[model samples]
Target: MAGAVIVHHHARYKTYPGEVTGFVFFACLIASVGGCIFGYDIGLTAGLTSTESFLILFFPDIYRQQKEQVIKNQYCKFDSQELSLFGSSLFLSAAAASLFASPMARSFGRKWTLFSAATAYILGAFLGGVSTTFPVLLTGRILLGVGVGLCIHASPLYISEMAPAQHRGMLNILFQFMITVGILSASLTNYWTGKFIGGWGWRVGLAFAAVPGSVIALGSLAIPDTPASLLLRGESEAARLTLQQIRGIGIDEVKQEFDDLVAAAEESKAVTKPWRELLFGGKYKPQLTFALAIPFFQQLTGINVIMFYAPVLFKTMGFRQDASIVSSVITGLVNVFSTFVATMTADKVGRRALFLQGGTQMIISQILVGTFIGLQFGLSGTGAISEQYAMCIVLFVCVYVAGFAWSWGPMGWLIPSEVYPLAVRSQAQSITVAVNMVFTAFIGQIFLTLLCHLRFGLFYFFGAWVLLMTLFIAVLLPETKCVPLEEVAHVWRKHWFWREFMVDTSADARGAEMRKRIALEMS
Candidate 1:
C-alpha cells in the first residue's frame, strides 16, 4: 500500500512556477469553455435585436412591411425595449445568482457548483432556442444568467488558488481572455448565422451555448477540486495531494502554503459568518471595500457599452451596419489576441504598468470618441457616417476597447483575488463579482437610454469615470507580482515605502505622489 502510487489530475490551471503546463492550460481552456458560452450568449443578443439583417433572415415578413400601413402605424414594432428587458433580466439574475455561488461552493464544493452551473446553462440555452414568445426568451436569459454568475465567480477562484505564484497572473488572466473570445465569437457567429443560416438560425445561436456548457461539464471531471475546498471540508490529505498537483513543485514548496491555510482557518475559530459579516463587519471590511470597489470602477469605465454596442458605435462612424458588426468582430479579435499579451506581459510588465498604460489610453480613446460624437458632422447633420471626421469615432473606440481588454478586464479579477487574504477569497471574490454583475446589469440595461437620449454624454461620462478610476487604482492597487497571494495583504497592511506614517496615511501619501508624478509627465 505504501508503494501504491495514486494518479492525480489537475482540472485547469494557468501557471505553475516558470513553466507552462500544456496539459493544464489545455484542460483549463476546455473548462473555460463555459466562458465562451458566457461570452457568446450575452454578445449574441445585440445581433439578435439590432441587426436588421437578423430580422430579414429570421422573419422576412416582418422586415418587408407594407409601405402604406405598417410603416405608418408602428403597432407590434420590433420592441427594442423588450429586448433590453430580456437582456437586463439576464444580468440581474446573474448578479442575484452570484449571491448563491459562495455558499454553493462552500457547501457543495467547487466541482458540484460548476456542474450545477452547467445544468443551468443547458436549460437556459434550450429555453432560449425554443422560445415561442418574448417572455420565454426573458425567462431563458434569466436562467442563463444564473449559470454565468456561478462560472464568473468560481472559475477565477479555481485558477487563482491552483496557479503557482510565478505564473499566477498568466493563469488567472484566462477569465478576461475567455470573455473577450466569447464576445468576439458571439458577434461573428451572429453575423454568420444571421446572414447564412437564415430562418430560425438565431435560435440555433442561443442554443449553441449548450456546446460549451457540455464541454465544461465534461472537463470538470478531469480536474481535481481546489485543495482549499477539500481542506475547508476537512479532507486534509486530499487537500495536500491537490496542492501538490496544482503547484507542480514538490510538496516542499507549497507545504508551507498548505500549512498556512490550515493555520489561518484554525486561528479564525472557523468563523462561518453570514454574508453580511463581509458587508458590514470589521473582520472583512478591507476586503469588502476592495470587493465592492474593484467591480465598481471596472464597470464605471463603460466597458460594456463597447462590448455590447461596439458595432453600433462603429455604425455611427462610416461602416455599413453589417460592416460595423464585422468591425466589432475585429475588435474582439484584438481583445482575444491582446489577452495573450496579458499572459506574456502580466507577470513581466506587472499589474501597475498595464493598468496605468491601459487607463491612460482609455481616457484618450474616450475623449477622442467624445470629440467625434460631439462634432455632429455625420451623426446629426448626416452627410454620411463615413465622413472623414466621423470615421475617427470608430478608430478611437477600437483604440479604447483594446486598452480596456488588455488591462482592467483581467487585472480587475486578478487584483481582487490577490489583494484579499486567502481566508476570505471566496466570499470577497463573490461580493466583487456580484458588484461587477450589478454594474454590468445597470449599464447594460440602460444602453438604450444612453444611446437614445444623451448620446455623447455617455462618452464623456465614461471617460471621466475612467480618469477617476485611474487615480483610485494608482493609489490603492499594490504591486502583486511575484508576491504570494496570501502575503499580498502585507503590501497594504504595512507601508514599507513611507514607514514614518501609518499605512493608511502612507497610502494617501503614495496616492498624492502618484498623481503628482502623472501630472508632471502629462505636463
Candidate 2:
C-alpha cells in the first residue's frame, strides 16, 4: 500500500473521462476472440469423444463400450484412459505454456503475445484436422493447449489495461462472455455435425477452430497495445496517444490519467526482480495468495464438470445420445445468458456481491443435484432413471451452471488480472493461469474416473468444495469494483487480514525511492 496520495486526487475527480467508446469496444472485441478458441475446445471435447468415427479412429475401446447393451454401469461405460488423455492433454501443455507466457507478454507486449497464441491455435487446428493417428492428434491438442495458455494469460490483461477502472469488470467479463458464445457455438456445431455430417464430423469440428484463431491474429494487428504496457516498455509518447485515443477525452483529462500510469510504471521499474519479490516479499504476499487462491477456488467450483463433460454426464443419467447433446446445448445457452447478466451487473453491484450470491446459489444447486441423483440412481448405477427425473437433474445442473457463469467464471479472470502491481502483474497472472490450467487438466483427466468410481457421489464431492470456497470468498475477498489497477494496493492495505502484509510507505517516500532507483539504474 505504499503509494503517493494520488489516490486522493483520483477520489476527488469522481467523474471519469472514459466511457465505453467504439474504439474501446472494438479492442475488447478483438482481445475476447481468444476466449472463443478456449471455449470451442471445451465444448468440442464433450461431443468429439461421443462421435462414432472419432471413437473408431482414435479410441475404439470407447466405441465398443458405447455399443454394449448388457446394462453396464452407467458411470463406468465411458471410462477410458485414452479418452481422458485426449480430453486433458491440451490443459497440461497449457499449464506449462503459461509459465512462458509471462515473459513473452513483458518482452513482446500483450498484443504480439495474442498474435502468437492465435498462430499456434490455427496451426493446432490444422494439425488436428489432418491427423490420422492418436499421436498426431495429441500433438495437435498440445499445440492448442499452448495457444490456450498464452491466450488466457494475455487477453484478460489486455482488456483490463485498456479499460477504465469504472468499466474494467464488464469489459473483462466480455472475454468470459465470448467464451460462453464459443461454447454455445461449439455445442450447436457438434449437434448438427454429429447428426448430419457422418464420419467426418470430428474433422470438421477440429478444423473450425481456425476461424477464431484467424480473428485474433488479424485483430491483434489492428489494435494498439495498452497504455500500461506501453509505459512499462518506456514508450511514453505512444502510451499517451493510446490513452487519449482509448479514453476519448480532452488533452488535460488524458494527461491526468497518463500521469497516474507514469507514476505506477516508475515505481514498477524500481523492482529489479519481480518474481523474487512476489515470492519472498511480505508486501506481495497477498497478491501471491490471491493469484494462486482465486483460480484454485474457481476450478473447485465444478463449473468445468458441467462445461467440459455435460453431454457425457447427461447421457449417464438416462438421456439418449442426441438428447444428451441437446441438453449440453441448453446448459451452454444458460451459461451464455447468465454471463450476460454478469456483464451488466458486475461494475454496478461490485465483485463480492456476485461472488457471494453466485456461490450460495451454486452450493444449493449442487446439493440438490447430488441429492436427486443419489435417490434416483442408488448405488449400483445399473439402470436409466425416468425421463422426469433426468429433466429434473438437468434443471438443477442449469442452476449450477448459471451460478458459475455469472460469478467465478468471469470474476476469476477479472480479479487476478486487475489486482497485481505493474511490476509483478505479468508474473502473478502467469501463476494464476498456470494454477487454473493445472486444476482444469486435473479435473478433466480424472472426471470420468471419478464418475465411474464415485458414481452419484461425484456431485457431492464438488458440492463440498463449493461450500468451502464460498466461505473463503466471504472471509478473504475484498470488493475491487471501480478501483484503478495502480491503486489496488490501497484496498489490500485497508483490509483486516491482508493489511498485515502491506508496508505503509507514504507517497513522497515511495516517489523518492523510485527516483533514486531509476537514477542508480541509469548511472
Candidate 3:
C-alpha cells in the first residue's frame, strides 16, 4: 500500500465493493474460448504441416524432401518459402487485423467483437478443411489469423473489466489457461487423427478448430457487456444494472462501485482522440512503453519457437514423425498444468516475482538445450542425436515452456489489459496484440532459417532475450497485485521511475484532497 491514497467511504465497505460471483465466472469462461481457439490454431498448424497428408497435398516438395533424407542437415530439411509463408502468413494478417480490433470493439462492444471473431475463425476452419489449392489454404490461414487478432484484443479486456479486483489476475489468466487447454486438445487431435484417420487426418484436425470457435460464438451471445464498456458507450443505467448483476448485488449495494466506474469513464471523455493521445501524450509514456515492450519481450522468450514448431523441432532432433507429434502433447500438458499453478499463485506471489522466477528457469533451460545440441551435432548440424539425447532435449524444452506458460504467456495479456485507462485501453491493447503478432510472424518466418544457419546458437539467442527481459521486470515493473483498475494510476504515479512521467495537475489535486480528508478522519 506504499504510495496509495486510502479513502474510507462507509462502514460496510473497506476500500472497494466487489465479491467473486457466478455471473462473472460464466462471462470469463465464455470469453476464454477466444484463447482456446487461438491456441488450437497454433498447436494444430504445427502438427498439421508435419502430417503426411498436408505435406503431400499443399507442399509436395517438402514431402519429397521428408522421404529423401538427403538434405544432410535435418534442421534445413523443411526450410521452404512456401511452408514458411503458410506458417507466417496468419501472424502477418493477425497483426494487420489487431490494428482495427480496437475500433471494432469500441463501436460494436467487446461481446459482439468476440462474436465476429468466432464467426471469422469458423469460416477460416471450413475453408482450410475444404481447400483444393495452396492459395485457398493460405486465404483460410489469414482469415483465422484475423479472428485471433480480434479475440486477443477483446477477451482479456472484457475479463479484466468484469473481474473483481481481488481476483482479477487469477480470472484474467483464464484466457491463457484456456489457450494451454486448446493446445493440448489440438495435440491429442493431431496424434489420433494422424494415427487412425490416414491421409485426410490433417483436414479433420484443421476442421476441429470450429468446435471451439462455435463455443465462443454461442457463448458471446449469453454474456453481458462489461460495465466499463457500457459506461464508455454512455449507457449509464444499463452500466449500473450490469454492474449489479455481475457483482451479484442489489442496485444500492453497487452504488459505490457504480460511482467509481462513472468517475473513470468521465475522465476518459476529455480525450477525444485516444490514439493520438496515447502515442504523443507524455503522461502516457510508461503505459505506451509497457504496451509495446511486454508483448515484444514475451515473443522474444521464444516460447513460440516451440509452440509454433514443436513437432518440426522434434523431428530435427531425431524423433520419428509420430513420436514428434506425441512429444508435443507432453509439452502441451506441461504448459496447461504450469498455467494452472500460475492462476493459483499470481495474486499471492505477485507478477514481478513470477516474471523473474520464470525468466530464470527459461534461461537455464535454453542454455542447457543449446549446449547439448552443440555437443551432439558438432558443427555439421546434420546428424540426428541419439534417441535418449532427443528425449533429454524435449525435457529441457518442457522446462522452457512451463516457465513461459505461467509468466510472460498470461501476464503479457493481463498487464496490458489492466494498466491502461479506459480512454486509451483499447488502443494500448491493440498495440500489444499487434506487436506480439508482428514478432510472432517474424519468428515463424525466420526460425527454420535461423535453425539451419545458427545451428545450436538459436536457443542461446532466446536465452539472452530472457535474461534482458528479466532484468527489465526486476528494475521497472511495479507490483500491481490486488489493485483496482481505476486505482492503478496511483501505483504508476508513485513509482520511482514512472512517477516523473505521470504528471496530471487535476488528478494530483484530487489525490491530495482525498489524502487530507482521510488524514483528518483518522485524527
Model 3 poorest ten-residue lDDT run: 4-13
- In candidate 1, where is summed lDDT lowest over 10 consecutive residues? 1-10
Tens digit of lDDT per residue, candidate 3, span 74-95?
6676787678778888888989
Error of 3 at 319 (Å): 0.5
Q: How close is candidate 2 to the true structure, as a TM-score?
A: 0.94
RMSD of 3: 3.5
lDDT of 1 at 225: 80
- Candidate 2 C-alpha lDDT tens digits along 158-243: 99999988899999999999999999989998998886645888888899999999999999999999998988899999999998
Q: Give lDDT tens digits, candidate 1, residues 100-161.
A: 89889877777777788888988999998888776676788888999988888778887776
lDDT, each prediction: 0.69, 0.86, 0.86
Each model's TM-score?
0.84, 0.94, 0.94
lDDT score for candidate 3 against the true structure:
0.86
The alpha-carbon lDDT assigned to residue 92 of candidate 2 equals 88
Candidate 2: list runs displaced more than 4 Å.
Answer: 1-16, 68-71, 504-508, 512-523
